[model samples]
Target: MSTQTGRCYCGAFHVGTKASPQTVAYCHCSDCRRLSGAPVAAFAAFDPAHVVITPRWPDAKSHAKGVKRWFCPECGTQLGATYDYLPDQVYMPVGLFDQADRWQPQLHSHADSALPWLHIDDGLPRNAASSRASLTMASCDS
Candidate 1:
């Protein structure tokens, strides 16, 4: 019920959401780790309508097709990503939150791609791909 506010590392971009996240996960996908420069990227997903994003720079880029990743022009801080595969949702890096401790990752996505040296013993569900990935094909049929 509480709102969450966040900004890019250099404060060039800002985002706020009043609605509860639709889902949260620690993603180990190669793209995520490469973009985040971390072993895992923890993010909270929300309906795009629920989030308000203000970007100081007009253009943000993504290497992946069908996905747009935004960053701060000033600091190049990776703010979030939106997938064309999931039009209803936006993924925000949990670390950007003003109070990141308040959020907990609900599961691990792309677990099969996780780094061999990095171990996660949090006991959450681990999916080879997003739990929602399987629903993608069916969703486009309607």
Candidate 2:
């Protein structure tokens, strides 16, 4: 199994995964954009059992129903998230991974919410809403 490691912006939180991600995706939802402070947010989904966060994982914050997000207490960097619908997986920002270059997004979620000014002409599939089926299927396949 391939292992990946990364740290928060302030280096106060470290994350390690013993296995490769189940899937990687780009989310254009406003909530994700606001949380990441980016036009689009990319995340790598993995089985929570395979991941470990050192120095402790701070309590999660839930501003939206069914979604819980974790951040670094020291730097406020978004660490990871878990959704009630996708309870089997945890999503971590791809930018937080040291091997981010290897984890290219496979699809775009909430494409309808994408900002007009941001144009990613990648031919990847674009889901008008949450790609729950695709995402869950990927985890099953993994």
Candidate 3:
């Protein structure tokens, strides 16, 4: 019953999903931090089956065991994110929606690797490390 829409930076990759999401989490792992080029990366989960993707956007280079990324080939915009391991839903870059504040982060992952200078006092759960261990601690109550 839940439905949402998102698009890539160049609007080449458009997505329509019909799942609200079990929870949304932030990743502070080295890969995430480096890929996002930020202190952390934010992602919202959706059922992969409920997502409809428009393959007009350029393909992305993937790493990790079960994840793939989509971006604008011409602009190199970090347009979208997805996970194959879970296989039920998809994850979209909250940035692409311009509704970053609408969905609050459930936790801060990889607190163990967080930059010493960065302060994480968002009042959300803080995971000392980046592992399913941290994610288990972040089980969304909602």
Candidate 4:
């Protein structure tokens, strides 16, 4: 029954959630890197029913099949995303959360795609590809 809130870079968009995240993890896929403009991107997956976006969620854009992303119209900050495969959860960038420090990633997804220069020896589980099975199980647990 914890609540987390955050706003977009330009303060044009806001988000809040009443429940804890189902999972938190790092994504090293090229798609995520380009979208986040970072070597790696971390996300916290939440049940859509527990999350609220002020004003409204922007229209989603799908550059890749099965993946739809939303961005703030004012500053273009990546807002959130949903995957057709993971219909029940929405993935929001960890950096966008006011309590980002509290949501450390539990695993590395698409580890094989991770940049060679990036060395994170946090001893977290590394999945060579999408950790959909693990992610799905985590949601079920919640």
Candidate 5:
């Protein structure tokens, strides 16, 4: 794993990791697009504790599904996505990184929510609220 660093658009959020993630993914869920204010959102999966986040909030403002979306309360910047089901890992948005080249997407999730103009040629596992979503529920503490 290579070292990677990231911060929010306004520098309100900062994260550091030793993750040279090549198996990243594209997410096209409506919630994601709306939340990110972009065509799509992409992230790299990593060990939850491998990341050292500063300005840590005791409570993160979140939107929940099977997972929890944490945002910077001050700036409303989406910081990272954490699975209530998978506590051992979390997905950090690639765009937040100052050094983003090491992580390249290997798959696309929520393909059905993808926009018409956007095209994904990569043959990866896709979910229109798919397995990742399902697995999240499956792994839940219900």
Candidate 6:
């Protein structure tokens, strides 16, 4: 498999993964929206073992139980996250990708928390919360 690469805005941090992402999705949870400063946040998840980080993040914050978000100290760029619920995966912000278009969000998650004014007309499945099943149904390799 071809490797995917990304870096923080200031180029202070970099990451690469040889494994294709397992799933890509738009997250509307409050933490995601607040941190991204957008109505929705998009992420592509891959096996943690396949992810190689340069200048590893020493500072991380857990906005809620089980989920830890890491940002670049130099640029404050939200780099990636890890969820206790999915211990085996690492979620990277799609915007950081060098080829962002390579992975498109197949679903909208945490739909119940979405802002009323935000309307995504993509026609993708909207789930009330984390939906691993929905991702599998989207034909993504587990």
* Clash tally, candidates in order: 0, 0, 7, 0, 0, 0
**1-142 per-residue lDDT for model 5 (tens digits):** 6668887767777888876652477778777788788888887777766777776732654455566766776677777777665667777788888776756666677777789998767677776653355333111112
Predicted structure 4, TM vs. truth: 0.93
Winner by lDDT between candidate 4 and candidate 1: 4
Better of 3 and 5 by TM-score: 5
Give lDDT tens digits, candidate 2, residues 19-130: 9989899988877887888899999998999999998888989877777889999999989988887878999999999999999899998888899999998899998888
Q: Write the per-residue lDDT of candidate 6 for residues 9-30, one digit (tens) a residue.
A: 9999998889878888888888
Off by over 4 Å in 2: 137-142
- Which consecutive 10 residues in model 5 have the weakest lDDT in total? 133-142
Per-residue accuracy of model 3 over 1-142 as CA lDDT, tens digit each: 7567777667766776676655677766677677677877777766557767676545666764556676677556665565554455455656655445777878776667778887767898777664345443221111
- Candidate 4 residue lDDT tens string, 1-142: 8899998999999999998788999988888888888999998999999989989998988777777888998999988888777888999888888999899999998898899999999999998888887766121101
Looking at candidate 5, what is the lDDT of residue 23? 42
> Alpha carbon lDDT of residue 9, candidate 1?
83
Better of 3 and 6 by TM-score: 6
Candidate 1 local lDDT, residue 65: 70
Q: Between prediction 4 and prediction 6, which has the larger TM-score?
A: 4
lDDT of 3: 0.63
Candidate scoring better on TM-score of 1 and 4 = 4
Per-model TM-score versus the true fold: 0.86, 0.93, 0.75, 0.93, 0.79, 0.87
| Poorest lDDT segment (10 consecutive residues) of candidate 2 | 133-142
Clashing pairs in 3: 46-89, 46-90, 47-88, 47-89, 48-88, 48-89, 112-128
What is the lDDT of every predicted structure here?
0.74, 0.85, 0.63, 0.84, 0.68, 0.79
Look at candidate 4 and give me any clashing residue pairs: none
